[model samples]
Target: MAVHPGDSPVHVALRTSDVDEARAFCRKMFYGPLQVNPVGDPAGFAFAGDVVTLGSITVGEISYGADVRVNIADLETAYHVLAPLNGSLWSRHRGTVVIADPTRAAVYRPVGDIDLEWPGDTRLLSVKVERAALERELDAALDQQIVSPLLLGESFDLAEGRGRTWSALVRLLHTELCAEEGLASSPRMAARWRDMVVSGLALTVEHPYGDEPAGLQGPRRPRTVKRTLDAMHAEPWRQFTAADLAAVAGVGVRVLQEAFRQHVGVSPLAYLRRLRLDGVHAELSRSDPWQVNVSEVAYRWGFTHLGRFAGAYRARFGVSPSQTLRERR
Candidate 1:
């Protein structure tokens, strides 16, 4: 149940036989102040794990040699996913019990207490995403405010559909970061990978907005919609807010929003984001990666947040911004 063959390319962050030391390491690295108790002989207990920080996300491969029970009171500012590589994991979150294995994973939100039972010799790929980062990605995707404490399913299936694809993306991230010479060294590439992981989870897991369609096709464009579109296309790099776009269309913000939804199938800000993404793509396609990195191009197109930009770019273009830059033809 190893995450890698032989030895992992990612350096081990912690390896200890003392339960106190292991608990301290987990507190500092993954979660804050949790209780870990051995389920079997204390003498057989051991801990080994590797951890890496990618922007607002933390990825780790962890294993406790003996069976143990973990009690976490609150995750506070982050969301967690524990996907076992070999043995199954028993997790209780929000009053539901889930037996997570290779085919299924456990997801914990920021608000609730989590109890987990790890069987002997179980290895797990652990992902921690900051709450703000994940929620921002969701907000951007839905173009609206998200309800607090997102109702994510306690158990996620990793054997089919988007869950399977998300699992593969997580493994790929692990592999790249573990490699000696991988693209993850670049900040831009790391940001892109982090966004992919967060966005993938948002799309894969059961949530309020999960059932919404990708886009809505509406009727023909009106004059106000046409004016707003012209303004956005003409100055994609300008920092145009909803009020600014509405002003350009000679209407109130709500009227402009309704008009855009009726004609463009998205809000003015969302359509403007699409325009900015297109600008970045066009610039990256012609620029050399060695001379100009993805961030510079992204920033030039009014993308202040690299993680959100990467998620939006990939959602629109089916590839990362760095990939578009590297594979320019």
Candidate 2:
């Protein structure tokens, strides 16, 4: 379904009476060689679902009329977070079992195979994130390559604190997605939303690298931070990696990262993201809404995910990019 980094989204809505058709749809949408077995009588079996994509992440809702068991050899390239909207789901990922409902959400890491049993009335709001994108975000945050597999825990508590906040964000995205034209439809917004989803997953889910220090051995320095900021302000559109910024600052990546946190109150990449966000805001504020799409201006400023970009823009400016464009118009 073109669920890759930097690709346009593929939207799908499917309802079928045949189990085989549902199985094929699941395999194609999730990129998993999955086996679906109805747990009970198939006489009244039915499947209904719809999915919306944002770059390498797919957010969707699905339900079945007949209870079923799903088996997968390996979800080789992606990680899935399934939060049930109604009913229940029991899952085992490489032997780690979790019960998924409204309060508890299931997290399936990329390296493991999975088995799931869904009740006949089970309905889920699923978030599927690409492995490469997750690793790339981690690499950017750490400023180093990660060679080991990232094994996340089986589930997270969605009833309280950060997990609840994350779920709310997901719901907000779903709401904006259903709008005829809104931030979720903008490329800039999707970029920011994608970043939030991946980053949020890493923060909320238990992973090995979650607590690892992200800075260098030496003390933080403002000069290094200034250098990185200068580069970002000069060329916010450049795909500048942590290594590249470190090179420009005449320091190691971790050192530059620490400098940014100490002096700028954010990491180097985050500073760059802010600059890009500002660029988008400025463009939207000056453009006519009818003549320019928020996605176009966001892409021009180097944003690739509309949902994320819109969320960040709203958080920063207290309004959506489209709102800014409309006011300007």
Q: Per-prediction count of colliding residue pairs?
A: 0, 14
TM-scores vs. true structure, each candidate: 0.62, 0.62
True-vs-predicted CA distance for residue 82, candidate 2, Å? 1.1
Report the lDDT tens digits of candidate 1 across residue range 174-233.
Answer: 878877678875556666777789888887787643343132112335778778877776
Please, what is the whole-model Cα lDDT of each candidate in the order they appear? Answer: 0.77, 0.75
lDDT of 2: 0.75
Model 2: what TM-score? Answer: 0.62
Clashes in candidate 2: how many?
14
Tell me the spans in candidate 1 whose CA falls farther than 4 Å from its real position: 1-12, 212-329
Per-residue lDDT of candidate 2, residues 250-314 (tens digit): 99999888776655567888877867876786566556677899988888888888899899888
Q: What does candidate 1 score in Cα RMSD to the true structure?
A: 15.5
